[model samples]
Target chain A: GAGVSQSPRYKVAKRGQDVALRCDPISGHVSLFWYQQALGQGPEFLTYFQNEAQLDKSGLPSDRFFAERPEGSVSTLKIQRTQQEDSAVYLCASSQLVEGGEPQHFGDGTRLSIL
Target chain B: AQSVTQLDSQVPVFEEAPVELRCNYSSSVSVYLFWYVQYPNQGLQLLLKYLSGSTLVKGINGFEAEFNKSQTSFHLRKPSVHISDTAEYFCAVSLDYKLSFGAGTTVTVRA
Candidate 1:
């Protein structure tokens, strides 16, 4: 089975610009999560979605960060007015069950460089 | 909120030698402990997880970790390491649906 997949593996954006990163979770996966990974650091959670509902977004650093998963399988993390500090790799993960304690499968991630 | 700490930023060990990566976590509630490995130019993959039951949990690539409640630690260890085991190891804690991660420990295995 195919694991999670993210589009535009590398994106270079100007400061103050907007960028949207897409994620395609594995088929039939019910849970999706977004995370940010800076260089030489582990990944930090950003937001999570169960189906179409965005359950957790507390990890989002600022209001400029937004995410949506309308249909359930695919999700998009949008950053408005990107800053140099937003330069990092955006990771997406999906899992089968939440309460059952299933492991989340991660995607390759999109590396965004803000110049 | 939960937080994870990896004591060592880097651990250099000779091939076929024993290695240990220390990890400690803090949380107000019960949490799930996990160890993940990331090779160069790749995303993380779960090495093992301790949700409940035995404190000693075995993971992939001959890796294992022991969950110590009193110490608030889950340190990964391998009796004999191979060169292929050289990579970044991350310790993570999850309370409810949120996941917290440590900075990560890079293990360099020298032949």
Candidate 2:
């Protein structure tokens, strides 16, 4: 892909329901990241993956937030028992280098609305 | 730990006029700085970054920023802006490959 790709550009779920968002990183990208952006706020880091290994998950807000990148190319973010506060944009980004100097390519993101 | 602070919540500029967005970061050690722009209904796009070397960094869409180590600031500037330049700007500091971002500043370029 020319850039990071995300599925289901928008989602609406009821309280207590579960939602899954998917991301397909660019070809040969070595690092993948997930972020959450609330309305009128900047994107906040949620998790990071170096290849298939999960290096950091400290940014995940709660136990209900989970992410996995089994193959290092595609990643999924799943939220269990969605709450009203969960309504926000879920973004996925990937970079070719593991170093912090390289720029991360971002996807359009999935806007989740919990009602 | 690293964190970023965007001084302005919003900035309004007319087309063909210059604009500046202020940003500051806090860290005990050396850090990587970045500026990202987000347009409506879209994802964030990298404006520029400061890793090392020259403090003046240039990026796409005629955007540039200067990284001042003394003041711990990375402010973005554009000599002339277009209506298309209206977007949300974010300042971030990278720590262990994770980015800590500021609240963001909304730039509205009017014609």
Candidate 3:
């Protein structure tokens, strides 16, 4: 695809249910980032990947929040136990060059609704 | 670590009127500032950025921002705004790699 693409534009899960959100970054993008955006709030960084290596996971909110990029093309963000507070829009962004100073192109995002 | 603050939670303005969105950041090291606009049901789009060189940076859609190092602020402005400019604006600062963002401000441009 020409731009970053995300799967399951909308996802709904019961409390305590596990859910996985997927992101397909632009082809040949070297840097990928995942973020969580709550109601009326800006997107918060969750994790970052440089190629196949997860360079930064410090932004992950908790142990339940896990992300991986096996082939360095697609990424997944898994939440072990869903909670009502976990409801938010999950955003995926990919940058063509290095992480620093390069503007990231974002996807439409997956709107996760935890019931 | 870097943190951002968007002072105005919401701003309502008339069409063709000028507006300003304020953002302030706190960082120990040098900062990279950015402004992103998020339309409804869409992801954020980069409005402008300040990495190095002149503090005044211009971006897409006639939007511009000034990076005030001493004040630790990067406020976005436009001479005149249209109804299409209504959206959520975010201010972010990157110290290393991870970008820390503000709470966001909702801008409504009434016709």
Candidate 4:
């Protein structure tokens, strides 16, 4: 892909329903990241993957949020039993090199609305 | 731990005027500073970053930022502005690999 790509640009889920968002990173990107952005706030880190290895998950807000980058290319962010507070934009970013100093390209993001 | 604070929630400037967005960060260890811009309905794009070599870092769209370790600030500035420069700007700090972001500042460049 020319840039980071995310699927289902918008989503509306009923409370208690599960939602899954996908991210397709640039080819050969070594690092992938997931973030959550509230209506009027900046993006907050959720998780990170260096290739196929999950290096950090400390930013995941709760047990309901889970992310996986299987096979090291495509990543998925799944939220279980969505709540009203879960409504926000889910963003994906990819970096060519290591984290420091390297620019991370971001996807437009998936806007999730828990109805 | 690393955290960023963007001082202004909103800034209004006319086209061709100079603009500045204030940012400050706190970290226990060495950190990387970055400014990112988000256009309407678009994802964030890196404006500039301060790593090590220099205190002043220039970025695309005529934006620049200076890293001040003593003050723990990395403020974005532009000598002149255009209407297209209206966007939300975020300040972020990275320690090791994890990044922490500020609340963000929205800049509206009026015509």
Output the better candidate (1/4) by DockQ: 4
Give per-residue CA lDDT, model 3, range A9-108, as digits (tens). Answer: 9999999999999999999999999999998888999999999999889878889899999999899999989989999999999998885788888999
RMSD (Å) of each candidate, 1 decimal: 1.0, 0.8, 1.0, 0.9
User: Candidate 2's error at A52, in angstroms?
Assistant: 1.2
Could you tell me the lDDT of residue A58 within candidate 2? 91
> What is the C-alpha lDDT profile of model 4 across B34-63, one tens digit per residue?
899998778899999888988999999999
Candidate 1 positional error at B13, Å: 0.8
Counting clashing residue pairs in each candidate, in order, gives 0, 0, 0, 0
Q: Write candidate 2's Cα lDDT for B1-111 as tens digits.
A: 888999999999999999999999999999999999999989999999999999999999999999999999999999999999999999999865898899999999999
Question: lDDT of candidate 3?
Answer: 0.93
User: Judged by lDDT relative to the true structure, which candidate is superior, 2 or 3?
Assistant: 2
Error of 4 at B15 (Å): 0.8
Instruction: List model 3 lDDT by residue over B6-109, tens digit each.
Output: 99999999999999999999998898899999999999999999999999999999999999989999999999999999999999998766788999999999
DockQ of each: 0.65, 0.82, 0.75, 0.74
Interface DockQ of candidate 4: 0.74
Q: TM-scores across all candidates?
A: 0.97, 0.98, 0.97, 0.97
Lowest summed lDDT across 10 adjacent residues in model 3 chain A is found at A96-105
User: What is candidate 3's CA lDDT for residue B48?
Assistant: 91
The best candidate by TM-score is 2
lDDT string for model 1 (B1-111, tens) is 789999999999999999999999998878999999988878889999999999999998899999999999999999999999999999999876667899999999999
Error of 3 at A88 (Å): 0.7
Candidate 3 pairs with clashing backbones: none
| Residues A50-113 of candidate 4: C-alpha lDDT, one tens digit per residue | 9988899998999999999879999999999999999999999999887586778899999999
Off by over 4 Å in 4: none
